[model samples]
Target: MTETHVPEKLKAPVLGAVITVSDRCSRGEAEDRSGPLALARLAEFGVEVAHPVVVPDDIDYIRSALQEALDAGARVIVTTGGTGITPRDNTPEATEPFIALSLDGLAQQIRLAGLAATPLATLSRGLVGVSARGDRGALIVNAPGSTGGVEDALAIIGPLIGHILGQLSGRTHEVESADE
Candidate 1:
């Protein structure tokens, strides 16, 4: 596996979470592949998965999972599922309240990257943002529920993950050493 090389300025490795948001998956009615798939991809990007949560499509459940991940000091949190137009699709809504700043480009890039494969990619309502709830808030991003979607999203995000998290934590600049 070719590991992603995070910039030198980023000294700390990413401690991350993957939250699977689907009512069926949450209830054991459907097999979840996206969450686990995303976690594996993240490993190649040098993000250490610290939490993996499965929550229903309900807004509260999604928010609770995000909150728990943040409390655990996750620097990056990626959620899959519930990003559609259906009545049960509430992941974006669930995420908005917790976000202090929006990273619209992250979601847009995912959609744009997938557009070549499927025009329906525009229908996803996923979001990306930062939550300043802790001392070093987490960078939160959402991806489509399908395994393919997770693959595409991760491929696009892998190169940018370190940069975004470094910015979120104000650590993009390399710290000077005593002799350097």
Candidate 2:
């Protein structure tokens, strides 16, 4: 597979993880597409992706996977699936406790992008945030369950991820916008 060259000049050591949340997928009743897609996208940006994991819609299981990934030195954990309004859609709720700071702008930006494509985007309920797990920090982003939704979210997220990683790692060379 060809890796997509990042636009930024410097490639920092960005570690990442992808979690797919789906009952059927986890039970081997259905194939997991979102997880692999997210992992591939992270790889394109030169991130060292930890072993991908898939869990059911259970909140406790989701939280466990998240904590394990963060403890393993993953700076970015993107979760796909379970961000909708269905009875089992509880990813956003499950993720709330881990987030030290909410990255509302990212969630909104991704939703708006998805909204342009389909009205279902408004109901995705995907959440994004920063988690200060002990001395380290990680950016946790929630993506929709569909393969296309994950692809659309990645199109907007991929470019900005480098900056987020730089901020998390305290990179002094970071270039901020004039307004900031």
Candidate 3:
């Protein structure tokens, strides 16, 4: 068999934003743990997180926040909360119009990982997608609102960050083995 080699593309370090969607949190009635949790997790990967925001669980509000983050040069927007099976949960619906592609596998993996910790994970309506904005072309992903859910989702996505960035920058290569 012939060996195949692919060059890796260089991508600039991109900015990110963490948006926590909860009515109480937006109203300053409850602490916003999910947003902070997401920021900390992303920081571990050396990603710069811009200002995080707490918004009510409203579709229009979430949509506006996403647009603002993208306009502010955030290449990745991770939203926590409003991804449940409730009447007020409208994250997926709000984000649908902004996505260029839906990353079902990522969301599925998150759900599966969350399931290991709680059966309620099956009810999570988290989603992942690429934003439709022409300039930013960012990847927008929605994860569960709880701290544990945020942790699990990031754990699942952590290993793929480099590859995703490579892909976004128009490079494809076989990831080097850990033993190497």
Index of the highest-TM-score prediction? 3
lDDT values, one for every candidate: 0.83, 0.84, 0.83
The order of the candidates by lDDT, greatest first, is 2, 1, 3
Candidate 2: regions farther than 4 A off? 1-10, 133-135, 172-180
Candidate 3 Cα deviation (angstroms), residue 180: 20
Q: What does candidate 2's lDDT look like per residue over 1-180, in tens digits?
A: 334444452266578899999999999999999899999987777667866699999999999999889889887889999999999998999899989988898899889988878998989888888897333788889999888888877876777777666666675453445565
Q: How many steric clashes does model 2 contain?
A: 0
RMSD for all candidates, in order, please.
Answer: 5.7, 5.6, 4.1
What are the per-residue Cα lDDT tens digits for candidate 1 across 1-180?
Answer: 334454542455678899999989888999888998989988888889954689999998899999988888888889999988999999999999988988798789899877878988899989888887344877788899988788878887777777776676565455455565
lDDT of 2 at 8: 54
User: What TM-score would candidate 2 get against the native?
Assistant: 0.86
Ranking by TM-score: 3, 2, 1
Q: Which regions of candidate 1 fall more than 4 Å away from where they truly are?
A: 1-12, 133-135, 172-180
Q: What is the lDDT of candidate 1?
A: 0.83
lDDT of 3 at 178: 48
Q: Over the stretch 19-104, how does candidate 3's per-residue lDDT look in tens digits?
A: 99999999999999889989988877656786679999999999999999988877778999999989999998888888888889
